[model samples]
Target chain A: MMLAQDTREPFFRPEWVSRNADRIVEQLIEHAYLTSIAVGVGSLIAIPVGVYAYRHRRAYVPVTWLAGFLYTIPSLALFAFLTTYTGLTTLTAEIGLVSYTLLILIRNVVAGLEGVPRDTREAARAMGYTPRQLLWRVELPLAFPVIMAGIRVATVTIIGLVTVTSLIGKGGLGKFILQGIQRFFSTPIVVGAVLSVLLAILADVLLLGLQRALTPWARSRPRPEGAR
Target chain B: MSVVSEALAWLSDPVNWSGTAGIPNRVFEHVRISTVTVLAAAMIAVPVGLLIGHTGKGRFVVVTLSNVGRAIPSFAILGLALPVAIKLNLGLGFWPTFIALFALAIPPILTNTYVGVAGVDPDLVEAARGMGMADREILRRLEVRLAAPVIMVGLRTASVEVVATATLAALVAGGGLGRFIIDGFAVRDDARILGGAILVAALAICTELFMGGVEKLARPRTSTA
Candidate 1:
């Protein structure tokens, strides 16, 4: 009944990281790849649904209800459930991750569009802008900040969830964690956990930068006095 | 279709309803763990959020904590907590799962509480003060009542999240319906895996619906906004 791990093995091993450097990088790449696919596909689906919801008003309730229902399912359960059909593949991971982004993204999209001032829309219409032109030329730009905020949240969330996919054997850095736990080894677990957190933070900062760059007007928008 | 029927059969079996490893016990374990984690998170977050919202101090810290909090993955938290728990001789199972889900539960409650209170009309607060009410009395009678809906939204969000992530407790050798999923994976039993997933999802959805009902109940009859 000898344990494979020495009793006093250090929690972090620099040498182990050095040995597994290539695979670690590969996993990191896979993690980023999975996150991007989910968020990208999610946005594609959510934007139109959000716009429709906003335009119809009546449709918002059921749309949100459906998204909320999907969002409520825990990631582990969704991933496991998907396994019954999709098996252990990247597709299964992507489906679970994308389903999550719908609620966050759709809500944000609708909110952003709604935040466009009524006066602004009226003014655009008065200036001879068609409905389609007004939406593209004025409303979308005004809505960009709120929409970008949603994207940032969704991206960060999807990145974290990508790690959970490892439980289904598709998680990028998550595989290290699963392995580390099974073997009673601490180094890989630390590596996987730290890298994933760092990745999340990095993605957040990058998305924030993108939002700022895209919505320069948001920075100059006048805030009411004393508004935090 | 047969897979689903098989899973249904697995779920309906009376054998799955008895003993320590039974479905009922597993569900109770899940609910118990989630309940404790959410309550603990609310206790810490509500007071802090209320103070911040009421006094308008430490606003930056709360915002930053919540922003960072949302970015950390639950699994990563579980992985990181493992060593700390081991070092403290906390052993495994509940402690590690509790640590992770508790952390997951805090940000939503804290942020919602702060926003709800701060958004309370300043004129109302001024009128309360002008009527000779003390700050504590205004917070209790006016602010808390006004902010109840938002606070409940936070509670709902935290409850749903904790319940969902509580499934990961199984990954750490912790008890919960998640154990069935993990065990099903080990045995390559598709029926058990699907059945476990259905149970976990049902519980999470129920939490959401129940919380949504509570939130609606908390809404002020005369809408202030």
Candidate 2:
């Protein structure tokens, strides 16, 4: 109904959704899978780097600068450039997606850990806690909310970036978007765009739930408004 | 390594420097669209941000909108816009690309402006009021002046983003440096693709540094005043 063309295909036909339900679900799963792998790998690398940067102080600038530099590269450009070497593999897609998450993940991890109150660490140390114990018990728990905030942002960002991967022949939901653009079909475009937005919202909400459930003691505190 | 060398060779080739599809023309197209999009977004966002920041009303809505806006992917916006553009007979490339990039650029400027302006010390506003200054005077002389740095941060963020995203304009038949990448892929020319990527990345970095310099300049002047 949204189209003015002679064919007049409805913007979102229920029959089309029913007929192509398998494809839609498959793309959704692919989108979610790519996002998780990127964020998961990104977090594994970022947390240790963040901890090191937090301790060394000198490492902070270089790590963040590298990440920011990578982030400034256009997603299309990165993916296109990578295709020459990596081919159309998911590895190519994951590398680009993971690179995008590094800035958000590392910055949040450092900020969250640093945000721990100084006096709390002092009090723990006064109680005969070891440096390791103080970090594990006193600092990380307090930093959990902030770290989780970074993860949520990274997750959402990766979901969006995954769409660009379709251009290189490896996107999940983005495949549909590219197909829609090429064919000039409203049904697929609407389906793809709507589902992608919904997926982002769903991921965000799920992470918020996880954040709240994990931090029972911090429940009384207000949530941070817009982590970035 | 050969990719890098070949890409450099492609960039350094004098033949690639002329014509409508040349490096200069593509860079011009890229900069033109990005500048217009950022400027258009600012014209709308800055005033609305000023109102929200100064009045202390609609803070929650604007913040929530920015949060949602951040989550929406640029490609999705472009995909959605393409159909509407076609339906409206707005042609293919530039209009859809502009609409998408414009949407992408607004949130940072609006949020930054609001945060910068709203964060001005209320006590300063009160003092300005005591001096018989109107709300407009207080906003222009005091709040906006203090908030300039934050607003610039927003502009810098938005500018860098716009420049980076403008590359996608090529995908929709629009002319830009992105044409090299898209066209490179079409003809399987790795050198041209990498060369184009380098150009786009370099442009984005220059925008970041330039805006940062502007931000620094804006900062010291206000403090000295």
Candidate 3:
């Protein structure tokens, strides 16, 4: 009996797995919420800045490069800077996270707006489409795919960065990963890494779908045709 | 009054000279660590990347592995390594930090090298072969030269990354600029905090300027190069 106990033959640990399974779902929910909220909020702000700068047709490079400079700030330092004032709240985290997304999304949106074929913009103007009408009707739909790609990259990056937020007592899968490291526990670390990868893969596939749906025009022609 | 004088005193001390003072030595040491890590990672990763680019197999492996490495983040890798290294009774300070920096520098160099080499024109490669250039000669004459800028771009980014990332070595109890930054923060000293940050910014800018000059010289002098 002592030998059996010491050897620990039962490897499944069904009891432990079942107990934390609810936590896995809860953590996943929290993580998804954190990223979507940041990306969504960031996009709302960036799209307008992008549109404004594109219309001005100047200051685009400098404004966007300035944004890129801010984007390159280390994630830990960024979060720490926010929490210093806001005191470890979700709001600070959101602000810090959302601001980072702006740089990437704004750059993409500007690129997308500029990428709209010159002929199309000229045609819209020739047909007496107002700036507003052209933007709403002609520019936005074509630009959506590239903007969404930026969001995809931003979302994935923020999800990984969310781990640093655990230092602020924000519980999520990051807490699991951090705690696992602190305790030197393999199972929890493995579980967190696997779940995080799964989250990334899931996000990638979802964004792929969204990208295709938004840019149906891209798929409509189906370049290179089938057989390689 | 004495404490205040001492505080300003350290900042103004003209005796603090590069190659002469401990302060400058520390800064150079950090730069040395960063350069060595990037160069080492590049040496291995670039060759592997070129091989992969030329053969065009196992890109899936290269991409997936790099992504996986990136996903873990550098701090976590250091955290994981510290205990294992300690348990093995291995040297902890510089060696451990080097390993972590090496890991962090690999992805960009590998991926960019592969991309730069692969982006070379297949027609040029074929023509060289048709002209009876040996495979080795063709690679030396064409592939490495064509790949230089992309590889340089990768190296540039990687070098900047290591400079930024080397700060985390302080977490492993190895001394670097992060020592000042983290300590300054711990004590709520804005002077030190901002001072350390300023130093890092200065280092990054200087490194970029120097490397830009170096890259200008290193260009292989082809039309495509």
Candidate 4:
């Protein structure tokens, strides 16, 4: 594939890196910040909602339905719609990004909680532990692996979606992508795409490590080889 | 209040409903592209996923592919594909967007098929074998039937995702309902943007609901004893 006919400017210019180093760092930082904040906020909202849904079987359907509906809204449309009220602010981007995480987190949270063994819960109750105590001590700890899995999925998804926030001028790696597209410059686009993908893989690996560290029991449990 | 009213007015405008760039035409483009992408993805993912599930090998590949798919932004893929497409003389718009959307649709379908098939009860498979069913017969009659709901879930996810992401086609000057949103951005027309968002959201919701219905129907009527 011949990249454009403009052979004067190389597809990847070494000098471009030197000149745009600061801007590249800033965009990477912005991307990380936006993704973390969105994931953080989403977990806060989704966990509680998931807990509520778990406690009340009736609410599970509606809660999941609403989240799923929000998830289905195109990221671009959500950002554009929010721009109407929020006016191209970081808040607008955050709202859209956070909303996408809810469905994944909530469903996972519930599934994790539900997957807790019935015997474990009964034993906890027999030990005279209050419901709240049982939840925090027994249930939540056991649910950590599943919940962490959800968080990993949500975090990775948010990282990808954060690129789209560049559409609203939020100055993430997506900004470089859009700029590169407009100018037909391959350097910035390649740099931005590669960095964003690396960031995603890094975040996923970090989360996996965190999950392993937190859920020691999960690691110790016997399992079929290569079950994952 | 005025925003909503203005968006309604724009949507209701008869002029917006006609012409090659009309709402209907744009929606058609959107649906047509999404349908083609989703079908293409399913055709490839389903068979591969089923094979992996049935044999219980290459499970690692599915997991890795799904992770990579989730990590790469669709926009990045679109951007990356564009220069290559242009370089290959595939032009600017449709093919690049189609390729990106196609990539987006594959992971979910593949993952779901693998999960569905793998999760089928071993006892059921054993019973089928005892009943003189061949491997192919067991897969088609027992595993596939039991795995249908999970497979449908994957299809529904891919469908909604493809439909929603197809909006980015406008970014590459391809046709879709996102034209309204992109054009509005260019001209700073709030009403047009909102109208476009509404249309996109409505389409997504409708697709989700329709697929959900299909899933429910595909579900086994009686417990798999």
What tens digits encode model 2's per-residue C-alpha lDDT throughout A135-228? 7888888989999999999998888899989988878888888887777776787787778878999998999999999899887866478532
**Candidate number achieving the greatest lDDT relative to the actual structure:** 1
Candidate 3 on A158-208: residue-level lDDT in tens? 777666566555635676656554554434545555566678678878998
Of the pair 1 and 3, which is ahead by lDDT? 1
Q: Is the docking of candidate 4 incorrect, acceptable, medium or high quality?
A: medium
User: 1 or 2: which has the higher TM-score?
Assistant: 2
How close is every model to the real structure, measured as TM-score?
Answer: 0.91, 0.93, 0.81, 0.89
DockQ for candidate 1? 0.59
Candidate 3, residues B106-192: lDDT per residue as tens digits?
888999899988999999999999999997887788998888878887887788777866765665556666655566556765444
Query: What's the C-alpha lDDT at position B181 in model 3?
Result: 57
What is candidate 4's lDDT per residue for A100-181, written digit by digit as tens? 9999999999999998888889998999999999889998898888888999889888888988888889849999888777
**Model 1, clash count?**
2
Alpha-carbon local distance difference test for all models: 0.89, 0.88, 0.71, 0.88
Per-residue lDDT of B123 in model 1 = 99
Better structure of 2 and 3 per DockQ: 2
For the predicted complex of model 3, DockQ is 0.19
lDDT for each residue of candidate 2 in B1-225, tens digit (9 for 90 to 100): 699999999999999999998999999999999999999999999999999999999999778879878777888888877877777778788998888888888899999999999999889899999999999999898888899899999999999988988898887788999999988988899999999999999999999999999998778363854
lDDT of 1 at A57: 97
Local distance difference test, candidate 1: 0.89
Cα lDDT for residue A204, candidate 4: 87
Q: Judged by DockQ, which candidate is best?
A: 2
True contacts kept of each: 0.66, 0.63, 0.04, 0.62
